[model samples]
Structures are given as C-alpha cells and as structure tokens.
Target chain A: MNSVYEGAIQDLIDELGQLPGVGPKSAQRIAFHIMEAETEDVERLRAALAAVKTRVKHCETCGNLAEGEQCSICLDPRRDQSTICVIEQAPDVQAIERTHAYRGLYHVLGGAIDPIRGIGPEQLRIRQLLARLQNSEVKEIVIATDPNIEGEATATYLARMLETMNIPTSRLALGLPVGGDLEYADEITLSRAFEGRRIM
Target chain B: MNSVYEGAIQDLIDELGQLPGVGPKSAQRIAFHIMEAETEDVERLRAALAAVKTRVKHCETCGNLAEGEQCSICLDPRRDQSTICVIEQAPDVQAIERTHAYRGLYHVLGGAIDPIRGIGPEQLRIRQLLARLQNSEVKEIVIATDPNIEGEATATYLARMLETMNIPTSRLALGLPVGGDLEYADEITLSRAFEGRRIM
Candidate 1:
C-alpha cells in the first residue's frame, strides 16, 4: 500500500501499477528495482519513453506504427504491393511479419468492431483501406483479423463491403494450432479443423 | 522482435523486459499499451521514475528506505526502542509493519549472507547495527530473517556474536502458514509446526 512507502516510492509504485498486468505487489517490486538500478539504466528507460512519444508516428497510408510518413514495411519496395492484409492492431502486423510467409502490405484497423463498446466500422481505418484499394494496382485482399468474435465481425463487415467490387478476397484459415494436441483443442477449434480438413 | 518495431518502440520493449518477472511477450504488450496511452499518463510514469531516484534515501540508523536522515519508524517516539527486529531488507520491514503486532524498532541488513554469491556479513549493514547497539538502551534483539539457508546462516552468525553481550536474542517461529493445507505442507514446515506446538 502507498502508506507503507515514502512519497517518491509510493508515487512510483502507483504509476507503475497503472500499466496493464502490473499489480500492486509487482509495482512495488519494480519500483524498488528501479531505485536500486544504475542511474544510466533508469535514464535509458526514461529516454526510450520520451523517444517513443516524440519519434514514433502512425503511417498515413496504413495506420501502422512508423518513424516517418510510412512504416518500414510500407516504404520497402520489395514487399508485395498487389496484396494487402487487413488486421486489428499494429502488433498484429508484427506477429504476421514474424512468420515471414507473407510479404504483402498491411492495413492496421486501429481496433476491431465491438458493438457493445460502440466501436463500429467507422471507428476503424476501413475508409483508408478502401481508398488505398481504389488508387493502387492491388489485386487481392486478405482479411487477417483475429479469429475472435470482434475480429470475425470486422472481417465479415469488410467482406460485405468488398463483395460488389469483384476483387478476390480471402480470410486466414482457422483450425487446430500447429503444435497443439488434438484432445486439447476446444469444440469450436475441433469443428473448424474438421470443416477445413483436406486430402494430402 | 526488435527488428519488428521501430527504434524507440523496440528500445522501450527491451528496457521493460529487463524488469523482474516480465518476459519478452509481456514487455511487448506493455510497450504497445504505453504507445497507445494518453500523453499525460506516460509523462506521469516518467516523472515518478525520476522522482524516486532523486528522492528516496536509506535511513541513516536502520538502513530502511527513508525520505530524509531517518525512516518514519525510527523517528516515531511511540514505538518501543527497547527491542529491535533485525531483518534482511527494507521490504521485509514493510511486511512486518503490516501485521501491527510488532510495535518495536527495526534494523534492515540490506540482504542476508550468501557465501556462494560472495555476499558476506561485510556486504550487509551488520556493523551499523552493532554501532546502534553500543549507544542505545535496547534490551532484546529479534532475528526475523527469511527461512532459507542464507537467512538461517545469518541468524546463527548474529546469535553467536550477540551471545557475549548478555542481551536477550530470539528468532521468529517457523511453521506451516496459517491458511495452508496440512497435506500440502512441506516436510520441513510440518516438522517445524510439530516442534512449535504450544501447550494450549
């Protein structure tokens, strides 16, 4: 509790507790760790925080995190310009990039379509994605949103919007994970795996 | 992972990962959360970090965390100065204070003696504790070190040193935790529980 610590220590603990997933005990541990850490290390962390706020910006074209007007993926000429993968956050782009299987451009939706939270199609970057499609020589649209309810809703909404445009669109396949055991798969995933089964 | 993010974002993730219990995935998640957070929130965290480093100082007498020359416990006249509870770190002092059962003074040794880690009595604040004993009207010493090997070793060493001083010295009892199941209690704890059973 704040009462247990002095002014600065309590303040640090309170601030650290505000971060996602960091509870009060964890915040206390972290605060003490920082207090014991080298001055240079604390300065580096502070500098990084300041730099992220000042230096990083969103790509005007795709809404992905970037250093300049466009992100590294959007700026690179080697990435496939004919295909654009749409997804819910900048981190999703990073996750897809880790696989190295896809070399296409990405459109970050900023967030998903959640009716309860009042996040609709307009809250996302759907308009920018459509604008990119209209001017560019893009051939295929890949909906790479998450497989959850909100992501599925967003993907369905995007699919309906693109139906009249005549461009071939696809969604990421849903099935049992690569390394997961069959017995451990949930009912939804088991059904999806069965439906998407193919002959070798 | 650093390759996936821009300069500042990657740096923030790397710094966050250095904290105790935070893995790479958690670091990334926190970094993104910070990126999306309001500017004022980020500034508050930074300010707290800076303030903690600049303001927090160890108590001159007991080595507990303090704002000035002495900690609040050391400065409080209502607390019993006749008894001193000697513990490992400042956090341990906080843990003991939370119970409200002990109303005496505290001496923080900074850490217990671990010979394997090259941390001996010299590394801790044992000398300062002895110095406090020379002038103070302290009648008893309560060793509240952790129950691990290092803590036990430190307590034994202190007891041997204090044996010649004609002062009463004791240790905190060790037994099964209050809410722990008897079947799940470890062998040493169960043995300690049996050894510590009172007549009542």
Candidate 2:
C-alpha cells in the first residue's frame, strides 16, 4: 500500500476525518467508497465544492443564504413580512420550510451565541435583525433558536434587546414532545419551561 | 443558500448520499463539512480519488491490488515459496498479514465462487494457482476462505480439485472464539465443534 496513491488516499482520509462525527475508520471507509465511485459522480462533488465558495452569499436584509442579492423568502411577495422567524443557520430555515407551518420570512443568525467559542452577538447578524424590526410593518419576531443551552441564552439575549427596542418578540414553545413520557423528562423539562402550555 | 454557490451544496449532497452506508442526513453533514474545509484539503481528496484509478493495478500472479507489475508480497524473497494461502480479496490479505502468524506466500482469487452471482471457478484466478502448484518446490496449500456458505462450498470444491493433484492441503480450524459463551453458539455451531483445541 506504500505507493504513489497512498499519499492521495491518506490525504482524503485526513480531510474526511475532519468532519463532525466522522472518525478515522469512517473516513477510511468514505475514502475507499469515493475511490470506487464513478468519475462523473466525483466530478459533481468537486464542482459543487468549488461552486459553494464562488456562488453562495448572505442575503443583505434577512441574512439568509442566497444566490442573489436577497434570499428567495425575502423576495417572495406571498410570504408575510410582519412575521420573521429567526434561526441559527440556513439549514434550520430549510427544516422549518419542510413543515410548511410558517408562511413568513426567515433570518439566519449564522450561529448562536457561544461564549466558549467566542461567538458574540456582534459576530452574528443581530444588527440586521434589529434593523428589520425597526420597520413598523413588522409586528412580531419569532425566536426559533434550538432548545439547547447556547440557543436559549442567545434567544434570551435577543429577546431582551428586542424589548428595549419596543418590539414584541416570542420564542418557540418547548415541553414534552407529542408522544413523550413525563418519567423521561429532566428536572428543567417537566416544569413547563414555556409560559404557554396546552393540554393535548 | 444561493448566493454564489447556487446548487453546489445540493449537488455534493446528492453525490455523497450515493455512498453505500451514507444517508441524506449524513450526506448533508458531510457536504457542509467539506464546504468549511480548506481548499488544499479538498484538493487532496480530489487528487487521491483520481490517483487510485491511475496508480493501482491487479497483481499478475495473485490478482490482489498492486502498485506495480506484481504485489509486494509476490516480489519478496523472504516469504516461503512452497506454501500459498488462498484468500478472497486484497483486504483479506491485509487482515491475514495483521496476525503476523503466516509467513508464506499468498494467492488472491479476486472473489469467491458464487453461483448466484454467476461467478464460477473458471472466472477466478484458480488457473494461476494450479500453475503455481505445478512447480515441485511447493509443499502445502492452505484454504483460508471465509467461514460462510459460499466460502465453505468454494473451499470444498478447491480441496476436491487439489486432491487429484497429489498435494497435501489443509483448512483453517473453526470453533468457538476465545472467551466466548457456549449458550450463544448457533445450530451449526455447538455441534462438531472442538472443545479446547490446540493450534498445530
């Protein structure tokens, strides 16, 4: 295996191992799979990789990922401008869209506030979000951050900031899942953390 | 996000999803990870993907993956010439080498004789193996096929074929694993199974 191709395979494995959950074993498996893949398929991935760096850009107003000056949601007239759902990333916007529950625009914050990772409010698109809130036509802002600790802290910080700006803000409700068990709930969970609780 | 990299992420995700064990979620994760990766790292993977096809070749004698005209094992003089251990694939050769117990030469058959898959003995490198046996210096031939239905049938066929050539052959011992429980043994097991057998 100590051949000219060994270095290339090792390099691929190293690159693949950098992924969030991919370990050395998984990286090796993925590298081998890629090696066995068709040339056209590999070219597609290569083209996509190059294209991401060259084509994708942040929307000027809502901070959502867009191919042009603004995201599709911001440009669409059918979407409600009065209600903007704020999220941590572009993928979150896609997740919400998949449900078809919110017929409103979205604001991607890029990431949640994580003191440990040195991610501050200023580093996010919080200022742009505030600018959007300045419009009197925008009646409500929905904080749809993740239910995790960092997400909660960011949401709380944003909510406090919005309150100072005289903007009515709301967060995504959380409690037991639709078919969850109370016994499995942690201490902070069963307390009905969200103010509004509906009996099923 | 369609800023500059319009459908690049989607295209990469689709390509990654085509892998054997990777799903859509994993593919998305991988695509994002690759996006965040450095250009050099991505280029390394691309180079490696191409190198495997250009550099690697099948060994003329054993049919195992090789870097040159023949595999390293086939060229090494320290390995015993009189004994050849037959395996199913190149990876199998690596697995055996990891044990450090076998110092003999090897013969990779490419794949097992699977009738359902239309692979017969003629399709494999069995002819090359017989040619190697014709040399009078060869003494023992070890059948190290996997312990499965197809493997068993292939080994039995090879054994019957070798018996006609007046050569002493042997099969790897099979039984309970070290520190394994008897209760977990299946039907084929716990019967004709060895009790505290010693390796020769």
Candidate 3:
C-alpha cells in the first residue's frame, strides 16, 4: 500500500544519513525509531534542535559555547587562569570536564589547521589565543588536540607558535590501550611505547 | 571565555546520542553539523519527523503504512489480490517495491513471532491476515520473513497454521552473499548451498 508517510519517512532518512557515521541502513533504522517514539520525546528533540541555535553563543573570552557573555567555566572563580587547555572543538571542553581531571580555562580553536580542507591558522582562534597569552596570566598551555595525524599537526603548529611567548607547552600522552595486548601493537604504537618509556 | 552555546549544544549531543548506532563521538559530530546546517534544512527534518505520525495510518487490509483508509497497493487495480507477499515490517515492503519484481499485494506481520520476546501469533496481524484469506481470492502466500532464526521459526509456525487452508506457500531463496568467498561461508550457509545444489 502506498503510504502518505512514505515521503516524510524518506526525507527523515535522508536528513539523518547526512550525519557522520550514520549509513543509509542505520539512518532508516533511526527514522523508524523516531517515528515510533513518543510524540513528547520527538518534540523534545525538535525543541532542543531549534533552541540550540537561538540560545547558544560563543564565549567572548574563550570561544566556547555559552548562554551569555561568559561561559560557566570562565565564570567559575575557582578555575585556574594560570593554565588553559586548548582543544579543537567545544565538546572537547565537556569531555575534559566530565573526567574532573582538570580545572583550568579552555580555548576552543573551533577547528584544527587542515590546509587540505582550506583551514589555516588564520581561520582558527589561534590569533585570539595568542592575544590572550600576551596578557601573561597563563603560564602553561596544554595542547590537547586529538592523537590522530591532523590533531598532532595542529598541536605541533601551536607549540611552535607559542614558543615565542615562552609559555610551557605539553601534549596528551599516547601509547597502547590499557589492558591491550603487546602482540597486537602496530609499529607506530610500539615506537610511541618506547618513546614514552619511563625510568622506573 | 565561556560559550553561550555550550548547554544547548551539549543537550543536542545527548539527544543525538540516543539514536541507534550513534556513539558519543558521532553524536557530537552530528550536533555540530546540525548547528552549521541551513535553518531551513534542519526545519525540513523537524517538519518531516512531526508529519509522519500525523499523516500516516495503517492499511486496514494489508497492515502497511498508509495515508488514507487503505494503502496504495490495496487500492491499486493492477496489483494482484490473488497473491499476497507477507513481510515482517513496512520497510521490507519498500525494499521489495524498489526491485519492481512483484505486483502482488502485501501483508505486514508487524513483527515475527518470538517466544523469548513474549510475542506470539496473536501479537502480530496473523488473525487479521487469516480473516482476509478466508474472504479473499488469495491463491498463493509468499512468506518473506527475514532469513534469521526468528523469521524461520515464524515461517514454520505460519506454514503449519496455514496447512488447514488449501493455498500454496513459498519462501524467498537464501544462500551466500553474491561476491562473498565460499571458504568463509558459515556452516548453515554451506548446508543450504548443498541442499539447493543444481543437478548440472
């Protein structure tokens, strides 16, 4: 039987398929799930989707997403201004916060330096970060880009740029996964394992 | 600096993460993509999602998703009422339609009989289907359930139930993937391969 819902369902699948990692099969599954979901649940998602753009804005100081002029992290007086964790995106800030591992300010680059994607240093918030550093309040900068090639390149680029300012820079540690088998380690991982070896 | 968008962005990530196959990383990526998308594009998705339930109905005869009292296949004069292609879900109907291989009517089982899930013949549209068969001119029944264990069990159960009637029944052919290696074929597949072997 021809369904009037056919076109709407197909459109939903197409829109969902646009998302990263959502293949057509997965998109169709999600579309059905959404269709079967409670009206209130679907409406919540729709309202959330619309509210995000209207309510959210970039933090004036950190470029992180915020509701007002200052983000929650920047407004929290207990946070350390002497150190700033530089990341590639706003969600990275949340990832760090979830761990409760660090209580410093954050600088979101919005994206990394991918010349192939036409993203250069100027396109990022690097200049603004540098300007913030010039005030001399931040003594240490943690370059926590992802461990992938692009992330490593971005960190390296930032490290060199911050060198002139004489701010101490560090990258996140990399090695084998915890409880991972040594035999399964690739050559690059084995090299990193050796490079990060301790005297203990 | 704090971002004004942080809370709303995080909310969107959380919502997207609830979808099937969408991991935390993928959810974050999708949230950002939605944020950057054209307002109208996102609204189209929202509208489609909202419209599916409001506009779509189930066909009284076939159980397929429909716009009006009956589905298109049920209403189409060209479709054969003398034969019925029974499938597990609405999307399966679309999958068959895409091939343009069958012009017979459809009967959506809603789901297969799974004792583990507490779903029996009564839970599905089996009663309605039997009622239709009693009154209609159906000569053949095509049990096109998925090739999985539950599908097989459901088909067997239905075949036994339909044994009381005089209509003939058939199942879709199943074997190996088209380009897959025979050496990698599972035991069940190998058994099917031998069982369906040609005389030539």
Query: Taking the tens digit of each residue's C-alpha lDDT, what string does model 1 give over B70-125?
Result: 99999999999999999998889889989989999999999999999999999999
DockQ metric for all predictions:
0.77, 0.41, 0.45
The digit string of per-residue lDDT tens for model 1 on A100-195 reads 899999999999999999999998999999899886788989999989999999999999888888778899999999999999999999999999
User: Stretches of candidate 3 above 4 Å error?
Assistant: A1-5, A174-177, A192-196, B1-6, B198-200
Candidate lDDT values, in order: 0.92, 0.78, 0.84
lDDT of 2 by residue, B75-96 (tens): 8899888888988866677678
Candidate 1 residue B161 Cα shift, in angstroms, is: 1.0
Residue B91, candidate 1: alpha-carbon lDDT: 89
Give every prediction's interface RMSD: 1.2, 4.1, 3.7
User: Chain A TM-score per candidate?
Assistant: 0.98, 0.88, 0.88
Who wins the DockQ comparison? Answer: 1
Lowest summed lDDT window (length 10), candidate 3 chain A: A1-10
User: How well does chain B match by TM-score in each candidate?
Assistant: 0.97, 0.89, 0.91
State every prediction's TM-score relative to the real structure. Answer: 0.98, 0.86, 0.89
User: Against the true chain A, what TM-score does chain A of candidate 3 give?
Assistant: 0.88
Between candidates 1 and 3, which one is better according to DockQ?
Answer: 1
